[model samples]
Structure formats: structure tokens, C-alpha cells
Target chain A: GESVGLHLPTLSVQEGDNSIINCAYSNSASDYFIWYKQESGKGPQFIIDIRSNMDKRQGQRVTVLLNKTVKHLSLQIAATQPGDSAVYFCAENWSGGSNYKLTFGKGTLLTVNP
Target chain B: DVKVTQSSRYLVKRTGEKVFLECVQDMDHENMFWYRQDPGLGLRLIYFSYDVKMKEKGDIPEGYSVSREKKERFSLILESASTNQTSMYLCASSSSTDTQYFGPGTRLTVL
Candidate 1:
């Protein structure tokens, strides 16, 4: 019954603009959440992560926000560039009982236009 | 730098043939995982190993098997490759349950 899903399947953004990607998760027991970017012909790369105890975490040009009450997570990219075009995925770490596994979402395709 | 490397970037095999996909990590991680990436389905876990000689069935592990004979190396085996098995296979390693470093996935095509 544990699943993660994105609000949109495709997002088209102009270069140098900000982009916000949203995700909703079903499992409240999930303790950790991560965002990953996968470019064409490449593997998924870790962008950022936030723990259940933390509400927000920031990285270079990227921010991850976690809202435990609504079971929502979001990734914001500032000044989005052409290189930022990729499929983004949100994963949750299920730490219930003795199980430790990372479950991935369906992913969102982000296209940056010049 | 933490590095995870797969044996091949791309592979092509015929149906009913046994396929072996190898992965090795240099970070001395205790956890290694194998996942299949498909369109719209995202990354589905096929198998995982917590430590040497230990294995666990992930969300989808029907047509695949794994071997973790060493700490740094993990292998995924396809007993009889099928057309439906043609998908990108990704290998990842993590020291803890938090962050997982992924290797450039192998695009496997079963002809």
C-alpha cells in the first residue's frame, strides 16, 4: 500500500525560470525522502534528501521541502537551465519494522526550453 | 569520490539465453541493489543484498537472481532472457539506508 506519486507527468519551463515539482506519498511511516534526476541515456542521480524530522533542506540551486501532515514533498529548482532537463523521481525510505527499502515514484519529465 | 560501476553500458542477448549483469562499487558499501527502469513504471527493485552471501527479494524478482559473493561486487542473472526483460538495469550501493549512489545503468536489449 506504500506508494509515491507526482502531481504532473510533464513540465515545460523556460530557461532561467523557477520550477516546482510536487509529490505525494501514502506511507506515513516513511522516515526519509529523496529526489533524483535522470537524464537521457543515464542513470538516476541523487539531487537532495530530507528526513522526517526536518521540514526543509537546501542544496546548490535546489531545495527539498517535506510536509509530514499532508504527506507531500516538493523539489524547487532556481534559475532552471537546459542541463536541468530530465526525468525527476521522488523516493521514500520505508523504515517500518526491520524493512529498509527505497520506493520510487512514477517520475516527472521536466523539459527546459530556451 | 564514491564510484559505482557496471560491467557494461549496453548489452544485447537473444531469447532463452542466460544473461549475467555485473556491478561493483568502490565505497565498501554493505547494501547493493538491482532495479529495472521502464517507461512510466519508474524504477522497480528486482533484488538487493544487505551483506556478503545474503540476498532479499525486492518488489519484482520473479525472472531474476542475484549473487553477492564479495563485499564490493554484486551480480544479477537472468536465467532465460525474454523480450519483456529488455529494459535498463541500474545498480546502486549505499552505506546506510539513506543515500544510494547509482551506477550508469546498462541498457539491455533482448532480441
Candidate 2:
């Protein structure tokens, strides 16, 4: 079946350091992959997304890399700050048509120590 | 900005009781979805609607049903709330793009 998984469940990093979170997806037919940030007591917010055809995509302070060969995906956060502490989720767009139904992985909790 | 709002942030219901989880979006998006977030299971899609009065069963829709009589409002119903169904329910809305905006999840506890 189609599923998305993460390499780590929790990650701790010092402020100003870089953070890397890894994910693996089983569905090769997924058209797009997205990263979301869920703060405490809040909903998951869209951070960035990359199409399946692309190797990488970048946002303001974050980057998403996609490797189709190994079915691996990763998110990198630069200058990790206290405000960046949240549970991060990676999702795959399984429904390719007008509907964007996604399969989300078990989130990775990121804690930044100041 | 696309704003998806859920009716409740937390709910408590007894077993065998019917529960209604309501969601509304202000973006006028054509697609709305309901998902349950469990501890290690991640977010599992329960149901989704593409248009008013039209719905589709998602990955996990056995104990749940949905209604979309209005374009902006989507509701998830639990026929008989069970102990295993205690989880965070999230609602989301999306346009033609692949991105989806999520609402603050409803943490429902079934006792």
C-alpha cells in the first residue's frame, strides 16, 4: 500500500545550527511532496512543496529535497531558531487530479534549544 | 489567505453517542477533506468532497460519514463514537493547487 514514513521521531538542535529531517515514501506515483509545520495548539501549516519531477525546492529559510530513485525526501532548516520548534510533517499527493488528498507521515518533532 | 476553521478545539463524548465535527473555509475552495491524526498512525484521510452534495470515501471511512451541502462547509459525522475513535480530527481545504490549508484540529476524547 501507499505510505510515507520518517527516519526520526524527535530531533534536538541548538539555536543557529542547521537541522535535517528525513522521510521515505513508498508510492512512486505521488505527483507532489509537501512539508508542513505544526506548532503546539495550532494546525499544520504549509512550509514548502516540491513536484515529483523536481530534485529540490527552496523557501525562505527551508529547503526540500526529493530523490525518486531511493524514494527518499528530506527537509533542511537553516539557522534553526526557537520559533522553529514544532512537529514537522511530510506528505505525498496521492490524488493527482483536482483533489489534493495527501498521505502524511508520522510527524518529526523538532526542538530547538536556545 | 485560505482560512480553514473547525467548530471545536476539543470535545468529549460518551460511547455510542453520535458526534458531529464541523469545518468551514473562507477561501471558497472546491476541495475539502477530513482526516484523523493518531499518535503513530499519522493523518489518515476519512472523507473528502469536491463539490456541494458530492463526496468520496477516503482511506479510512468505515465509522464515519460526511456532508457537504454548502460549498464552504464540510462536516464529519461519527455514527457511534468508540474508544478507538478518540483522536485529533483535522479539516482542510484546497484549491486547484496541490497545497492544502489545515484548520486547528479538534481533539475528541471518547469515554
DockQ values for all predictions? 0.74, 0.79
Candidate 2 iRMSD, 1 decimal: 1.2
lDDT (10s digit) by residue, model 1, range A1-114: 778999999999999999999999999998889999999999899999999999999999999999999999999999999999999999998667334578899999999999
Which residue pairs in candidate 1 collide?
none
Task: Find the candidate with the highest TM-score and give its number.
Answer: 1
Tens-digit per-residue lDDT, B1-111, candidate 1: 789999999999999999999999999999999999998788999999999999999989999999999999999999999999999999999986558889999999999
| Candidate 2 local Cα displacement, residue B104, angstroms | 0.4
Q: Could you give the DockQ of candidate 1?
A: 0.74
lDDT of 2 by residue, A1-114 (tens): 778999999999999999999999998888799999999877899999999879999999999999999999999999999999999999988655437778889999999999
Q: Top lDDT: which candidate number?
A: 1
- Which 10 residues in a row give candidate 1 chain B its minimum summed lDDT? B92-101
Off by over 4 Å in 1: A97-99
Residue ranges of candidate 2 with Cα displaced over 4 Å:
A94-98
